[model samples]
Target: MERLTGRLVQMYGNIVSFLRKCIFYILSVGLIPNHIAFIMDGNRRYTKRLNLMQGAGHKVGYSALMSMLKYCYELGVRYVTIYAFSIDNFKRSPEEVQSLMDLMLDKIEELLREESIVNRYGIRVYFSGNLKLLNEPVRLAAERVMLATAKNSKAVLSICVAYTSTNEIVHAVRESCEEKWDEITLLNSSGGYVPDESDHLIKVTDIEKHMYMAFAPDPDIIIRTSGETRLSNFLLWQSANCYLYSPSVLWPEIGFRQFLWAILNFQRIRFYFDRKRKQL
Candidate 1:
C-alpha cells in the first residue's frame, strides 16, 4: 500500500510538471517579454485578510516573488524587477517600518544560503536606489548578495528598496552632472579644447546612462496587484511605452494563472505595436 501511494504521488508530480512545460511552450510561441516589473502591493492587506500577525504578509509575498521569478526565467524572460519598498514607505509607523527593514534584511541573507533561488536559476541580484539610506547591516547584506551573484548571467533580479521613481531620476541627474564635469575638465586640460555651449549641454542619453537600471533594458511589461491601476511612482522614466497590467488579486494571492493572462494580453497587442514602430 505504501509503495502504491508513493508511486501515485510521483506520477501526479510528473503530470503537473508536464503541464507547466506546456504552458511555457505555448507562451513562447507568442511575444515573450524580455523584462517584467512588478509592483508587489497589498501585502499588509493580505495579512489582514488572513488574520495573521503584523508583518506576516511580507513573508507570504516573498514566497510568491520567488515562484514568479522562477516562472519568468523558465519562460525566457531575462530581467525581472520588483518594487520592494519605496522611500515614502518610511513615513509609516515606526514598528511597521522596522518590520519591513528586518524582513528585507532577512530575505537578503536567505538568498545567500544553500539551495537559494539565486543559485538555482543563476540569477544576478541587484538593488537599485539610494542604498545609503538603509541601515548598515541591511546595506552590507544586500552588497554581499549582489557580489555573490554578480557572475550569474542567466537572469537579472532588481529589487527597488529605499526607492521611488522621483528619487531615481534625481540620483541619475546628480551622477550625470559629475560625469559631464569630468569630461569637460579632461577636454580643457588634456585635449586643449575650450568649452562651448554644446559642451555644457546634457543629452537624454547622458542621464539614462547614469540611471541605476542602465544595465537592463526598460521593462516591456509592468504589473501591479490588488486592483491598483496607478503606477504609484514606479519606473517613471523607463515605462513611457511599457504595457501595464493590474489584477484584482493581492500580490500574495497571485499565481501562475495571473501571469499567464498577463503574457497573453501582451501577445495580443505586440503585433500592432511592431507594425506601428515600423511605420514610424
Candidate 2:
C-alpha cells in the first residue's frame, strides 16, 4: 500500500508538471519579464494563522520561494531577486532575529548542494546588500555559494539581505567616489591639480556600475505578498518603471496561481507600453 501511494503521488506530480508546461507555452505568445523580484512578506502572520511553532513560517516560506523560482526558470526568466533580510529587521526581538539568521544560514548551505534548484537551473547566486552586516558564519556561507556558482551564466538569482534601497545607493556612490579618488590621487602625484570637468564630476553610470544589483537588469516585475503595495525601501532606484503585484496571499501560502496572475498582468501592461512606443 505504501508503494502504491508513492506511485500515485508521483503520477499526480507528473500531471501537474505537464499542465504547467502547457500553460507556459501559451504564455509565450506574449512578451514576458526577463527579471522578477519578490518581497516575501507575512511569514510571521502565516505562522500565527497556522498555529505553528514560532519561526516555522519562514521554513514554509522558503519552500514557496523554491517553487516560485522553479516556475520562473521554466518560464524563461533570466533574472530573479528576493528581499531576504532587511537591515531594519535587526530591530526585531533578539530571539526572533537570531532565529531568522539561523534559518538563513541553513538555507544558504542547502542552496549550495548539487541537487538544489539553483544548480538544476544553472543559476548564479549573488548576495546583493551590505553583506558585512551579516554574522561571520552567514556571510562566509553566502560568499562560498557565490564562488561555487560563479560559473553558472544561464540564469541569475540575487538574494538581498541586510539591504535597503537607500543603503545600496549610498554604498554604490561611496565606492564609485573612492575609485575616482584613487585615479585622481595618482594623476595629481605626478603633476599639479588638473582642473578637468570630467575628473571632478561623477557620472550616473559610474555609480550604477558599482551598485550591488549591477549584475542584473532592473526587475520587470516586483511582487510583494500579503497585498502590500509599498516598496518599503526595496529596489527603489532600480524600479523606476517596473510593475508591482500585490497578492492577497501570505508568503508561506503563496503558490503558482499568484505567480501566473502576476505574469499575465505584467504582459498586459507590456502590451500597452509596446503600443505607446510604436506610436512614438
Candidate 3:
C-alpha cells in the first residue's frame, strides 16, 4: 500500500504540472507581451546550493539565459533585455571579478562564432552599457556581435554589462546638454532665439532621447529571480511602466514554467490596466 501511495503522489504531481502548462499556454495566447527584461539573479546562490565553484554558477546561468531567450522568442516577444553585470559588480574580489570578465569575453566570442544560431533565429544582439570599462578583447567581441546581428529584425536582444541606472542617467544628461548647445548654436546662426537655461529646463522626453535604449520600446514585463523584488538600479526610465515579477527560483533553475507564470501575471495586470484606461 505504501508503494502504491508513492506512485499515486508522483502521478498527481505530473497531472498538476500538466494542468499548469495548459493554463499558462491558454492565457499567454490571449495576451502576449512585446518586451521582457530579466535581472537574472541568483547565480551564486545556485552555485552554492550545488556545491560548485563560483564560476560554474555563472556558466550555468549563461546556459539558462540561452534557453530562456529561445523560449521568449518562441512566445512572440520581440525584444528582450538582460542584466548580466552591474557597475557595482566591479567592486567584488579581484579574483572573482577577473573570472567574470573572462567568462563574459568567452561568451561574447562564442555568440559571435554561432552564425548558424543568428541566421536561424534572425536575432540581433546589442550591448547597452558603458563599454569603455571592459577589457579590449571583451569590448571587441561585443562590438562584433552587435555588428553581425545589426540587420536582423525578428528579435532584439540587449545585454547590460557594466551598467548602472544612475550612471546612465548622468550620461544622458551630459549628452542632452551637448545636443542643446549644438542646437542653440545652429539656431543662433539662423537668427532664431534659443531659450535660456532658466527658461527651458530639460524635459523628460529630451532626457529619454539621450539614453542608450532610446530606440527600443519600454519593457512590458521585468522578471527577477531568487525572490528579489528590488530593481537594483536597472532601467529606471524604461521600467517606469513595467510589471515586476519576482520568482523564488535561482537564475539557473528557472525554466519555462517560471517564464510562463511571469507572462500570465503580466497579462492579468495588463488587462486590469486596459480596463482602468477605458474607464478613465
Candidate 4:
C-alpha cells in the first residue's frame, strides 16, 4: 500500500509540474515568433522505445506535425519550416529511404484533399530542396501543393526534403555566377572583356536572393526534438539570428503543449536580444 501511495504521489507531482508549465506558456503566447523552424528528429528512437515497426514512428510523427502546425498558427506564427528529410538521410537503408519517399508523397496527396481547412486558413505550402532527386510522383505532388496554395497569404509552411544548407548555398553561388557571366557577356558585346562563369565575382547578397527560402523572412526560432543540440545542416543562412531550443521529447511525442513551451522560451530570448540592442 505504501509503495502504491508513493507512485501516486509522484504522478501527482508530475501533473502539477505540467500544469505550471502550461500556465507559463499561456501567459506568453502573445510573444510567439513570427517565423519558426523545426528539426523533427528521433522517429526511429521513438519506434524502438515502443517496439513498433520502423515506419510506425514516422507515421506518429506526422500526426504530431499536423497538431503542431495548427497550434503554431493559432499562436500567430506567420511562417513555419520543418526539416522533413535531409540529404544525408539518403545514406540510410534503401527500404527505409523508399518508405520515407512514399510517405512524403502520401502526405502531400492527403494535404491536397484537405483543401477546405488549408484554404480557409490561407496556408501556403512549399517544398524546398534539390527536387530533381525526388521521384516523378513525389515531384508532381509537391508541384500540385505549391500551385494549390499559391494564393494563400495568411501563413507559409515549408517542408525541406532532400535538402542541405551547404547544397543550397552552393547552388545559390552557381546561379549567381551564371547571372554574372551573362552580365559580363552583355557588357563585352559593347567593349569590355568577357569573363568566364568561374571568373565571375559573387556577393553574399546575390547568393542570398537565389536560395529556396529567399522569399520568406529568416526564422526567428528553431526547435529540434529528441534532445539533439546540432542544426544538422538546416537553414544556415537564415538561422544567423535565430533562437534554438531542444526538448527531450521525440518528434512523435511532441504536441500543442510542447509547441507552446518553445514559443515561451523564444519570447524570453527575444526579450534578451531587444534589451541588448537598446543598450547598444
Candidate 5:
C-alpha cells in the first residue's frame, strides 16, 4: 500500500508539471519580452521576517533567480540581466556586506563547477560592474565564470555586482570622452574652433556604445520584486522606455504566477509600447 501511495503521488506531481508546461507554452505564443532585467530586492527583509541566519535570505534569493532564468529561457526570452549587488550596498554593516560578497563568490564558483542553469541552457554569463571594488578572490571567481561561459550563445545572463546605473553612466561618459580626445584635439588644431560649440559635439550614440549593458539591446521589461516602486538606481539610461513592473513580493518568494502576471500585463500594453517605440 505504501508503494502504491508513492506511485500515486509521483503521478500527481507529473500531471501538475505537465499542466504547467502547457500553460507556459500557451503564454509563449503571445508577445513575450525579448530581454528582461530583474532587480532582486528585499533579501534582508525576507531574512528578518523569517528570523533566519544573516545570509540565508540571499541563498534563497539565488534559488529564485535561477528558477526565473529557467522559466524565461523556456519561454524563449533570449536575454536576462539581474541586479545582484548594488554599489550602495557597500553602506551596509561590514559583516553583512562581507556576507553578501562571500555569497556571490560561492554562487559564481558553483555556476562554473556545477551542471547548473547556465550550462543546461547554454547561457553565456557576464559580470558587469566595477570588479576592482570586489576582493581578489571574488573577482577571480567572477572572471572564471565569465570565461567559462563566454562562447555559449544560446542565451545571455548578465549579473550586475557592485553596480549602479549612475556609475555605469559615468563610466560610459569617461570612456567616451577618452576615446574622442584625439578627434577633439585635431578639431581644435585648426585654430578657429568655436568656443561656444562645434558640429563635433558629443553625440548620444557615442556614449551608448560604451555602456555596460550595450552588449544586449535595452530590456523590454524591467521587473523589481518588493513593494518599492522606485528604481533604486538599477538601469536608468537603458530603461528610458522600458516597461517597469513592481510586484510586492520579496525576491525569494517570487514565483511563476508573479512572473506570468508580469508577462501578461506586458502583453496587454505591448501595442501601446510598440506605438511609443515608433514615436521615439
Candidate 6:
C-alpha cells in the first residue's frame, strides 16, 4: 500500500503539470503580461501566526518566490520584479536587520550556482535600488551575480533591496540634474553663454533614464499578498495604469491558484487599460 501511494502521488503531480500547461496555452491567447511586480508582504506576520521559529518564515517565503518566478517565466512574462527589502525596514532592531541581511547574502550567492533559477531561466539578474545601503558582503554578492548573468537575454529578474519609490524618484532627479549641468552651464565654446530656460527643464525621458527600474518596462500588474492593496512605495512612478492585485493569502501561502486568478483578472480588464492608454 505504501508503494502504491507513492506512485499515485507522483502520477498526480504529473497530471497537474500537464493541466497547468494547457491552461497556460489558453492564457497566452489573451494578453500575457510582459512585466509583473510583487510586493512580498506579511512574512513576519506569517511567522507570528504560525508560531514558527524566528526567521523560518523568510526561508519559506524564498521558496514561494522561486515558485512564483517559475510560473511567470513559464507563462512568457519576460520581466519580474520583487520588493525584497525596503528602505524603511532599516529601522528594525539591529539583530533582526542583520538576520535578514544574512539570509539575503545566502540566497544571492545561490543565484550564481549552475542549477539556480538565474541559470535555469536564462535570466539577466538586476539588483535595482540604492544598493549602497546594503552591507558589504551582501552588496558584493549582488554585484557578482548581476555581472555573471548580465548576458542572459531570455528574461529579466529585478530584485529591489534597500529600495523605496520615494527614494528612487529623488535619486533619479538628482542624477538627471548632474548629468545635464555641464551643458546647461557651458553651452558656448568661450564658456560665457547664459543658460537657456529650456536647459533648466528636465524632461520626462531624462528622469526615466536614471530610474532603477529602467531596464524593464513598467509592470503590468503589481501583486501584494496578504490582502494588502497599498503599494507601500514600491514603484510609484512606473505604475501609472497597472493593475493592483491583492490576494488574501500570506506570502508563504501563495501558490498557482492565486497567480492564475491574477492573470485572469488582468486579461479581463485589459481592454479598459488599453483604451485608457489611447486616451492618454
Per TM-score, the best of the predicted structures is 6
Q: Evaluate residue 169 in candidate 2 and report its C-alpha lDDT on the 0 to 100 scale.
A: 95
- Give candidates' CA RMSD values in order: 2.2, 2.2, 5.8, 6.8, 2.3, 1.6
Tens digit per residue, CA lDDT, model 1, 163-211: 8899989989999888888988988798887866666467889999988
Please, what is the TM-score per model? 0.92, 0.94, 0.86, 0.84, 0.92, 0.95
Kindly report which residue stretches of model 6 are placed more than 4 angstroms away from their true locations once superposed. 1-7, 188-191, 196-200
In candidate 1, stretches whose alpha carbon ends up further than 4 angstroms from where it belongs are 1-10, 189-200, 275-280
* Model 2: pairs clashing at backbone N, Cα or C within 3 Å: none
Candidate 5, residues 97-194, lDDT tens digits: the string is 98888888888888986678889999999898888899999999989998999999999999998899999999999999888877678778977455
Pairs that collide in candidate 6 are: none
- Candidate 2's displacement at residue 87, Å, is 0.5
Query: What is the lDDT, from 0 to 100, of the residue 183 in candidate 5?
Result: 69
C-alpha lDDT of all candidate models, in order: 0.91, 0.93, 0.86, 0.85, 0.89, 0.94
RMSD of 1: 2.2
lDDT score of residue 218 within candidate 3: 86
Better of 1 and 2 by TM-score: 2
Instruction: Write one digit per residue (lDDT tens) for candidate 6, span 184-263.
Output: 66666566777666764688999999999988899999999999899999999999889999999999999999999999
Q: Evaluate residue 38 in candidate 1 and report its C-alpha lDDT on the 0 to 100 scale.
A: 98
User: What is the overall TM-score of model 6 with all chains considered together?
Assistant: 0.95
Please report how far candidate 6 places residue 101 from its true position, in Å. Answer: 0.4
